[model samples]
Target: MSVTTTLRPPATNATAFVPSLGIALASAAAFGSSGPFAKSLLEAGWSPGAAVTARIGIAALVLLPVALVMLRGRWHLLRRNAGLLIAYGVVAVAAVQLAFFSAVQTLSVGVALLLEYLGVVLVVLWLWLRHGQRPRRWTVAGIALAVAGLVLVLDVLGGMRVDGVGVLWALGAAVGLAAYFVLSARDDTGLPPLVMATGGLVVGALALGVAGLVGVVPMTVTAADVDLAGLTLPWWVPVATLSLVAAAFAYASGVSATRPLGSKVAGFVGLTEVLFSLLFAWLLLGELPLPVQLLGGVLVVAGVVAVRYDELTAPREPDPAPSLTPEAPAPPR
Candidate 1:
C-alpha cells in the first residue's frame, strides 16, 4: 500500500514514463483482443450476457488464489477499501460491459463503440469541472484530434440510423468508462493493482450473474466449436482468452499503468485499443478496416503521443518548503 501511495504521484519519476507507456500499450492490445474472441463465441450461439459473465467470472476464479497470496495478512486493507472495490466492479466492470452489449443490440458495433468512447471526452471535462485540472493548449489539441480520429476509425459517418434506447445505453456506458479510468488512477485506496483487478472481476461477475438470473440479461451458451479465422477450435479457447488475457492481464496492466501515467494521459493512450481492436478483427474475423480508418488510427496515435509529451514536459511544482514559524494572523475587518 505504501509503495503504491509513494510511487503514484503524477510525474514523480521522469525515468518511468517510457516503460509505463509500453505497459499501457500492452494492456490496450490485450483489451482489443476481446472483440474478435467474443464475436466468435457470439456467432457460436453464446449470448452477450453469457460471454461477458464468463469472461469476468472465470477470470475471477483464476485470479482468486493470486489475490489471496498477495494479500497475506493484509485483510485490513481489503476491509478499508471495500467501497472502492464495489464501485470498481459495478461502474467500471458491469455497467461498462453490460451497457455496451445492450447498445449493440440496436446500433452497429462501430456506432455503439463510438458513442461509448465519448467517455474519453467526459474524462477531460470531468477533470476540468470536478478537479479543476484544466487542460492546457496541447491537451486540448490532443483531445480534439483524438475525437476526430475516433469518428473516422469507427466510421460512424457511414453508420445506419440508431435507436434512441440504444443511444441512451451507450451514453450510460460512457459514464462507466470514465469511472474506469478515474477509479483506476486512484491511489488513496491503499490496495495493489492486482487486488483491485481481482476484486472488480469478482464483483462484476456476481452483479452480471444476478442480472442474468433475473431475466435482465439473456444467458445462452453452447458447446459448439468456435470458428476463428479458418480454424475450428473448442469454445473454451476463446472463453479462455477472454478471461485470462482480456479480463485478467488487461486490467492488471492497465491499473499499474495508470499509477505512473495518471488518468488523463493514460486515458488518451487507451485510444490505441480501438486500433488494435480493428487489427484483431481483421485478422481473426476478416473485417478489414477502410483506408480512412487506417488514417484515423494514425491521428489517434499522434494525439496520444502529444498528450504524453505534454505531461512529460510540463513543469513540476515542487512542494512548498516547510515554514520555520507560523505566519501572523490576518487583520480582522
Candidate 2:
C-alpha cells in the first residue's frame, strides 16, 4: 500500500484512542508469542505445515461462534465478500504463517521475524510501482534506514552462513504479509473486521488441509512431549496456546485495533511483535540476540516511527462538496 493509502485519516474523536492502542499492543503481544511456541512444537518433531494447519484450524473453530453472533442475521456479508475473504485467508493467513514457520525451522525466531517484516517495505514499493503513488520524504527515509538495518541484522558483511531455502521462505512470508496490509486497508467491502478475520481463518485452515491432503506440503506431527522454559509438557500444551492466544485472540484483537488505529499506525505498532518475539525466544528457547542485532532492531523501530510520524503530520484531504440536485418546484403552493 502507498503511504497515503496505508495511513488512515486522523480520528476525529480522541476518546477511543487509548483503548485502541491497548488492544493493538495486546494483539502484538499475542502474535509475538507465536514464534517461540511454534518453534517449541517444531523441536518436538512437528512439521511447519502441520503445526500451522492445526493453529489456524483450531483458532477458526474457537472464533466461529463469536463470528456468527456478530453477524446477527447479517450473514449475507459473508457471501457478499467471499472473494476478499478467500484472498485474505489463502494469502494473508495461510501462506504467511506457513512460510514463516518453514523459515523458522532453519532461522532464528528473531531473524525470521525481521525478514518477514520486510513486507512493510514491499508494500511501499508495490504501491509506488503499481499505483504510481510516490512515497513522501519520510517514507523514503524510513525505507532506506530499514533496508540498512536489514543488512545489519542479516550480518551479510560478516559472511554468516545462512540457509538459502530459509531465506527464500522468509521472503515469501514477507510478500504474503505485504498482501495482508494491502488487503486489510481496503474499505469497499464494508465487512466487519471480526467477521473478516474469523472467515479468513476458517478458509485458510481449509486451504491448508487441502494442501496437506494433496501432498503439496509435508504434514507431520509427533505425540512426544514439548520443552518449554525448562519444563517438559505434553505436545498439546503449546498447540493449545498457539491456537487460542496467538491465532484466535491475536487476529481478533488485531482486526479490532486496526479499525481505530488505521493501517499505517497499526502496522507500525506491530513492530513490537519483533521485540516481543525476541524476548519470548530468549526466555523460552534460550535464543538471545547478539549486540549488533539489537542495534539493528533499534534502527528498524526508528525507521517505522519516522514513517508513521510523517503520516500523522500529513495534510488532510478536504471534504467533498454536497450533491447539487436541483430543488423541486413548489407546485402545491
Instruction: Output the number of the TM-score-best candidate.
Output: 1
Per-residue CA lDDT of model 1 for 111-211, tens digit only, reads: 88888988888887877787777788788889888888998999988876599999999999999988888888887777888899999999999999999
After superposition, candidate 1 runs with Cα above 4 Å error: 1-8, 12-14, 318-333
lDDT of each: 0.88, 0.79
Per-prediction TM-score: 0.92, 0.85
Residue pairs with colliding backbones in model 1 are none
Worst 10 residues of 1 by lDDT: 1-10
Model 2 residue pairs with clashes: none
Displacement of residue 331 (Cα, Å) in model 2 is 6.6
Q: How close is candidate 2 to the true structure, as a TM-score?
A: 0.85
Our tally of clashes for model 1 stands at 0
